[model samples]
Target: MSLSKLKLTTCLWFDGNAEEAANFYTSVFPNSKVLHIQRYLKNGQELHRQEPGSVMVVEFELDGHRFVGLNGGPNFKFNEAISFQIDCANQEEVDYYWAKLGEGGDPAKQQCSWVADRFGVSWQVVPTAMKDMLASEDKAAAGRAMEAMMHMKKLDIAELEKAFRG
Candidate 1:
């Protein structure tokens, strides 16, 4: 069967802390919630279930994307190769996300479009008007806006528009 036809889901593997991480994520994003949780038990006795309180699997949705969190033991870690991008309308949105996600995490400078959160989850927080401006017929304006954007940590839509007009 083709992978695309197999009801593909993004499965996140956590180091024995799937439940905690899921809850944390749901709290951070709007319209997010933990859909269901499953526990592992053996025979008549709950082995991993009764100890350490690890979650076998947690189904959740963040900003409408369905994801599964598995307490698969710390066999892997999150990397920047894959990341979630947030398109914001203003600086307030950018700052809010930067502060919330950057807590306890390192931030990598990527102009006004990117930041890596504490959990090694990289995010690109960009202005919603970026596409419109970049697609403008005015090449000089688009280039100027792009230059301005490349120097910011958090995108400012107003500033970009100003640059575009210059």
Candidate 2:
């Protein structure tokens, strides 16, 4: 299969904190950076009604994935239906993301390695081994791992491995 030269980017809708969210995301993830920012101008104020120099959109990269954060007002909000999955290598990595992404968000939304960040974006800080364990040929072991995982918010790699072994 030939890869297309076109670069696909994910757009994150923000009420009025596109730049803040972009900065937070860049800080949390390594190899990430804010690329560009577009501001609202005077001529377009009639439609947007935003301050002339206010942020309109912030283009950023988080761990090599490109994303655009749009300051599209509060007309829309993020829900649990869609979320980004972060593949973590170990318990420490999972903990790091859980704390970083889950901070200042709705605590009630956290469940089974899934969390909503302060900006209302959902993320699943999942351990890479969890996928392999859940896909094991042994039905009983896989079931045990799933059962164990379902009970935890921030995933524990050792506990998951133990469940897989059982």
Candidate 3:
């Protein structure tokens, strides 16, 4: 969606690395770019304590979804409760995203297709077919697929399909 057509934008709080995070995100996704970067000014220096010229907010879009990264300071941290999900069309897409997003991430948090990036942003990389596999009318098939998925870190589409068919 175009920036003008965006009804709501997600603002992500960062710790003095809003621009860097925005660059990283834009590089990872196709059709994405850093739309704008705003730096801090003297107006709120006393309250924010940020360098006058330091990055304040970065507005960017990832495959049409607009996001804002704000250098809101060290008061907040990203948690696993919230994450972005990438639906892959096949195994190749899944592998690509898993490796890219999972780079430099905490290994402990890499499980069941969920990965925490270097900047502590969490993402889920799953094949598009996964939705159908896990929601099939056949309860037994769906259960098998679910069980197989639980043991995986990056999702395996072939394995999930095999289990579902069994």
Candidate 4:
């Protein structure tokens, strides 16, 4: 949705890295771009503790999703509780995102198609077919798919389909 039409947007807090993070995110996905940037002014420097002209906020969009990245200092940090889910249509799509987002990320956090990026932002590179496979009317098939997915870090759609058929 366009900025004016949108009612809500995700705001990410960063410790003076909002601009860099916004650029990184826009580079990762197609149809993404940085919309605007707001810098700290001399008047607000006392409260923000930032140099005048330093980046304060960056507005960006990633594949149609709008986000505001704020240089809100280190008081807040990102955790696994909140994550962006990317619906991939195929293994190739999943692999692309997995490699891109997982670069310099915590390896231990890579589980169930979930990865915490270098910026400590969590993302789930999931296959589009996963929901349908796990929601099938056939309980046996659904259970098999679910079991297979549990052990996967980067979901393998072919393997999930095989488990569903079994």
Reference-based TM-score of each model: 0.79, 0.95, 0.95, 0.93
Worst 10 residues of 4 by lDDT: 1-10
TM-score of model 2 vs. true structure: 0.95
lDDT of each: 0.78, 0.94, 0.93, 0.93
Write down the worst ten-residue block by lDDT for model 2.
44-53
Candidate 3 lDDT, tens digit per residue, 1-166? Answer: 6567438899999999889889999999999999999999999789999989899999999999999999999999998999999999999999989898888888899999999999899999989899998779999999999999999999988999999999
lDDT at position 131, candidate 2: 95
**How many clashes show up in model 4?**
0
Ranking by lDDT: 2, 4, 3, 1
Q: Model 4's lDDT to the true fold? A: 0.93
Model 1: lDDT equals 0.78
User: What RMSD does model 2 have?
Assistant: 1.8
Candidate 4 lDDT for residue 118: 88
Model 4: lDDT of residue 127: 92
What are the C-alpha RMSDs, in order, of all predicted structures? 4.0, 1.8, 2.9, 2.8
Off-target runs (Cα >4 Å) in candidate 3 are 1-6
